[model samples]
Target: MFKDRFEAGERLAERLEKMGPFEKPIVLALPRGGVPVAYRVAKRLHAPLDVIIVRKLGAPFNEEFAIGALVEGEPERIVLNEEAVYRLGVGKEYLDRVVAKEREELHRRQKMYRGEENPIEHLSGRTVILIDDGIATGYTMKAALAAIREQHPAQIVVAVPVAPPDTLSEMERLADEVVVLETPEPFWAVGAHYERFDQTSDEEVIDLLKKGKERTEE
Candidate 1:
């Protein structure tokens, strides 16, 4: 069992080195949770690191229930939570509203974290490694892949500390390569596997980016 996200990242870093040097690949991590893991990955690989913000569309009434996610790309893609939508009787109007709100949040985040920096480079003709702490619904990760795919990357990798067996298997269909460190059976919540699964703050995310950028620049 891993001590926490950092230790898990260290283990993942060692395994990823076998794949060879990153050379020019960019490490884009899903923010809030993925930052710590990606920090370790970027440091180990000597690759530039950045954040890719994604917003999940939760069900109406029970907002915690994820029904879909929104991501930005060359051509934006939306994968519906058809099962949840159907079962919950989530109407089109609610979805549209949620999407609009999320879009605004995404933009706000871009301005806040990124400032005047150039938008993340297109993944086309480049190796793109997508990092996340873990996956539960898989909807968020799926939407991320769809967004990345639109840019036509030469390769896409999904790297995570741990995930369910079925979720890991499903990722293969979306990414060129998947570097999963652990696929524990009878997986409980992602937090269960981590000894210190604190809610990562925005400041922590910023600190990671700074450290990662400096390391990669060198």
Candidate 2:
């Protein structure tokens, strides 16, 4: 288990350096847990950092268990975790309501943090690095990757500190290149590898994102 998120991110960056130069790499993190990792990456690579906003759709009663995710956009999408949703007895109507609720929250987050500014237009023929803490089901990461592919980056690299063997393999198939520092066999959960798995707030995510943007503009 890592002492904290920062340590995990540091280790991840070290592994990435061996891959190749990160010159002008756009480090994109899946907020809010991914922000801490990306912050370290941006620092180590001396590259611009940015956060891709995504909200997890939780079960009706237990809000922490993500049944899916809602990505912000026009005609916003609700990517459901079929396994979780079925386990939670989330039907189509229930799922639709959940999607709408999460979409509303997504709108609230963008308005509160990013204002009306659209994400940077993806410059084609450029490398893009996507960072997250860890992966299990990999649904959230899948959603993020799909969204990024829409932007048409020259390359997409997915990096993480730890992941299940299957989950890491899935990322390898989805991303142009996958760099997972550790793929612990018989994985249980992301929290198992984290010494301090505290919830990251919206404010912290925003602050880190602002840091990334300012660094890029410098």
Candidate 3:
């Protein structure tokens, strides 16, 4: 098991270096848990770091059970679990309401994390390395991939510390490459694999982003 996110990030960065010689790479993390992990990778690679804000769309009664995911954009990108919706008998009205609510939260997070800074506008022809703490159901990451695809990036690489094998398989179909440090059998929650799984605060995220920006400048 990984000691913490920073250690996990170090190990992950080591693995990524072995792959070697990426073309005009840029690191995009899934905040807020991803910022710290991505920061380590960005520092190691001397790459620019940014966040791709994606939120899970929870079920009507069970907020922990994700039915879909939404990613921030001019017109936000969404990916739904059709089987889950059909099984749960979810209606369009409910889905619409949730989308609106989640979009508002996404905007709030964008402002809090980025302030007046603009998002990276030029992703075309660059290799995008997408990072996160770990993957659970993988819906949110899928939404992130969908949003990134629209930008016409040269390659999309999804990297994380740990995830279920099945989830990694799904990611492989969407991304050009998938780099994972661990895929434990009988997988529990992402936190179960980490010794220190504290919630990442908004202020921590802001500070990390500031540091990441400075890294690129230096």
Candidate 4:
């Protein structure tokens, strides 16, 4: 088990550095958990850091269960879990409502975090290192990958501290390269692997981004 998200980020950074010679990769993180981990990685690699806002569209009856996911980008992307949607008897009306709500949140977050910065414009033909704290269902990351793909990145690398073995395998097929620090078995939750798993706040995320911007400006 890792000490915390910071430690996990440090260890993950070490592994990525050994992989070597990434082509000016921009680090895109899935907030609000992924920011801290990605911050460490971006600092280590001297890469530009940004957030990819993707929200899971919860089931109509049980909001805890994700039926699909929405990714924010130039043209917003929506990825549905067909089986789940069908099994749950989810209709277009429900999906439309969920999509709209999530889209608002996505735009709000983008404005709050980026504030007119055109990072998306620079993504084309650049390697992108996508970071998250860990993976459970992996739907969120999958949606993120779809959005990144729209930007036409030169390469997409998915990096995480820990994930279930099966989920890691799925991610491998989706990403050009997958770098994980651990593929723990019987993974119940991502937090179980961390000694101190505190929830990352919006303030914390903004601070990290500000710091990252300062680093890039230097």
Candidate 5:
């Protein structure tokens, strides 16, 4: 188990470095929880670090149960769990409402984390290593992949500290390469694998992004 997000990032970075010589690499993190982890990897790779904001689309009554994921863009991208929506008998109106709410939160995050800077626009031919604290249901990462694909990246590498075996397999199919440090059996929540799994604050994200930009300039 990782002592904290920083330790997890260090271990993950080590494994990725061994894979070696990524071409025109850029690290894009799913922010809030992902920034700290991605910062270490970006520092090690000497790659530009940026956040790709993606939000979970929760079920009508159960917010923790994700029915889909939404990512912002010219025309926002969404990935839904069709089976769940069908089984739950969710209607278009409800879906639209939930998406609107989540979209608001996504914009809030983008503004808080990035301020005046524009979203990174030069991903067309670069290798994108996507990082997060860990994977649970895999929907969020799936949506992230779909959004990144729109940018026509040379490669999308999903690197995380831990994930369920099944989810890891699914990621392998979607990303060009998958780098995971652990796939624990009977997997529990992502925080369960870490000793200090505190919630990452918005201020922390802003500071990390500032540091990342400075490093790139250096």
Candidate 6:
């Protein structure tokens, strides 16, 4: 178990550095939980940090169980777990509502945190390291990978502090490289791996992004 997001990030940075000489690398973090962790990685890697906003589309009955994810991209992106949607018998109406709600939040977050940075277009021909605190269902990560892939990045790396074994297996195929600190079997939840897992607020995320931008400039 990790002490906190900072500790986990520091450790993750160590692992990332060993995979050194990352060419024209840029770090894209999945906020708000990912900001702090990705902040550390960006600082250590000496790379510019940006946010990749994604929202999980949960099942109709149980919102915790993700059926798909909505990712904000140039044309926007949606990745669905066909099995989950078919099994749950989700309809177009429900999916449309969820997508609309998530898109609104994604746009709001982009404006509030990014302030017109326009980092997505720069992904082409650059190595992109996508970081998150951890993975549960992996729907969000999958969506993020798909969206980033569309931008034609030189390579895609998925880095996380902890994730289940099965999720890591799936990511191996999606990402050019995968860095995970822990893959605890019978994983309970992402928060369970951290001793001090607290909710990261929008204010915190914005502050970190600003700091990351400054660090990159220096």
TM per candidate: 0.92, 0.88, 0.97, 0.95, 0.97, 0.97
Candidate 1 residue pairs that clash: none
Best by TM-score: 6
Indicate which candidate wins on lDDT: 6
- In terms of lDDT, model 4 sits at 0.89
RMSD of model 6 against the true structure: 0.9
What do the candidate models score in CA lDDT, each in turn?
Answer: 0.82, 0.79, 0.91, 0.89, 0.91, 0.92
lDDT, residue 100, model 2: 78
In the range 1-218, model 5's lDDT, one tens digit per residue, is 99998899999999999986888999999988999999999999998899999999999889989899998676778999999999999999999999999999998988888864545467888899999999999999999898888889989899999999999778988999999898999997999999999999998998999999999997
Tens-digit lDDT track of model 4 for 1-218:
98988898899899999886788789999998999999999999999899988898999878867787898767778889899999989999989999999889888888888887756567888999999999988889999888787778889999999999998777988899999888878888899999999999989999999999899999
Per-residue accuracy of model 6 over 1-218 as CA lDDT, tens digit each: 99999899999999999997798999999999998999999999999999999998988989889999998877888999999999889999999998898889988998999877668778999999999999999999999998888889999999999999998789999999999999999999999999999999999999999999898887
Q: Is candidate 1 or candidate 6 better by lDDT?
A: 6
RMSD of each: 1.8, 2.2, 1.1, 1.3, 1.1, 0.9
What digit string (tens of lDDT, one per residue) describes model 1 on residues 174-210? 9989988878889878898888999988888888888
After TM-score superposition, what is the CA distance of residue 14 in candidate 3 from its true location, in Å? 0.3
Worst-scoring 10-residue span by lDDT in model 4: 114-123
Q: List residue ranges in candidate 1 displaced over 4 A.
A: 116-120
How many residue pairs clash in each candidate at the backbone level? 0, 0, 0, 0, 0, 0
Relative to the unseen true structure, what is the Cα RMSD of model 1?
Answer: 1.8
In angstroms, how far off is 133's CA in candidate 3? 0.5
Error of 5 at 178 (Å): 0.4
Of candidates 4 and 1, the better by lDDT: 4
Candidate 4 TM-score over all chains jointly: 0.95
The segments of candidate 3 whose C-alpha lies over 4 angstroms from its true place after superposition are 116-120
